[model samples]
Target: MTEQPSAAAHAKTQADFAANLASVRERIARAELEAGRTPGSVRLLPVTKTVPSDRLRLAIAAGVEWLGENKVQEALQKSEELADLPHLKYSVIGHLQTNKAKYVARFAHEFQALDNLRQAQALQRRLEAEERTLDVFVQVNTSGEESKFGLDPDDTVAFVKQLPAFDRLQVKGLMTLAIFSTDQIAVRRCFQKLSALRDSVREINPDIKELSMGMSGDFELAIAEGATVVRVGQGIFGARALPDSHYWPGFAH
Candidate 1:
């Protein structure tokens, strides 16, 4: 069994969360400026995957209106636990199986890791049944890593064209995970590839504009490459116990 944090420990954690949030915002602003973009051009998405519900409540209290979760079941539980926070919205940022579409349709305001048609069809049917619409981003494996869950960059444009048929699903933009590496050049190349892919797709579908890329370590490079949404977790919530390889297979240690 896990031990609960002491009251003083919990208080310290909340204070840490507030401080981390402010620091991340400042970093984002600096990154945007370095990239010659407006201060608020990129939105910081706090990822709450694996975080306990009580700690998440503290995050919501710290003015995090939109939460990103890597697992559907966890997000659902958190949503239920914090249902009173009407302003809070959840975005599913992890790879999703078609069978789990109903869970996302039931509550998620956005789905960021959409890669295949079967999952799209499933989500469309579920959203239709729920009488709702969901904003989705086509996930692309810009890093060309076989272990990553995203459509091939070359296939993304054709794939996106087919999404309009699913009236209940709105194609908001594209999302990608840069290569996890200590080498900044290798990491930036991944973001650059995604940005280039987005540019090409944009010409064909003018409405698809958002590029959800970046994470705690490489968001600055992503911002320089025009990332509109950065999914930050560790930078805000502190380090998670899991290693990067657990989340992204083949991630460099």
Candidate 2:
């Protein structure tokens, strides 16, 4: 079993989860206000990558409606385990393999890291067979990082133009993993790039509007740069047993 993030009792308590969730929401709301965005314009995606189903109950209890998972199999297992929970939707926010499209097609309500036609086509086929449409985002690698999984900023326009053929894959927005760094300038630059990329791509596909960027440490900066959705895990679920490299291969080794 993947252990809960911290050894401290406070980390495992319902009161702690509730408090943490409220704090995150307040921060998001504050950022939206500072950015001149309308109230609740920014959506907070509570990332439950390593959180167990038992602890997830606490999060759902505290009013988390959507969960972001990095791996399709892990997301599937949790979905099966939490089947009785009402109205909870899963968003697969990590790099997805073409072979795993069936799993995502059946389980996820949305997929946020789509960068290639092969993956998109695979997902479209599966979704068509499943008789469901999937909301997707074209991921952009704005930081110029080789380890990150996304289309290069220069390639995004051409890439998005091909998405129309995959009707079952509803291109709802854009997603990106900014350079994992404390340098505010570098991080914010990433959000700026994705925001710009979204504007350019919107000309080709008007529905591609949402920008999913930022994480636990830099979401405020992302919001300032026009992030419609932020992916946060440790900020709410304490911490995970594995390091980020486990999910983001070749990053921060």
> Using alpha carbons, what is the TM-score of model 1?
0.90
Pick out the ten consecutive residues of candidate 1 with the lowest summed lDDT. 1-10
TM-score of every model versus the real structure = 0.90, 0.91
Superposed model 2: Cα runs more than 4 Å off: 1-10, 243-253
RMSD values for the candidates in order, in angstroms, are 6.7, 5.3
Evaluated against the true structure, the overall lDDT of model 1 is 0.83
Regions more than 4 Å wrong, model 1 = 1-12, 242-253
User: Candidate 2's residue-wise lDDT over 1-253, tens digit each?
Assistant: 1112222223476788888887888888888888999999999898888677888898888878999998887788888889998599999998899999999999899999998989988998999899999999888999998988899899999999888898998898999998977677898899999999899998998888899998878888889899999988878877566534323333221
Show the colliding residue pairs in model 2. Answer: none
Best by lDDT: 2
lDDT of each: 0.83, 0.85
How many clashing pairs does model 1 include?
0
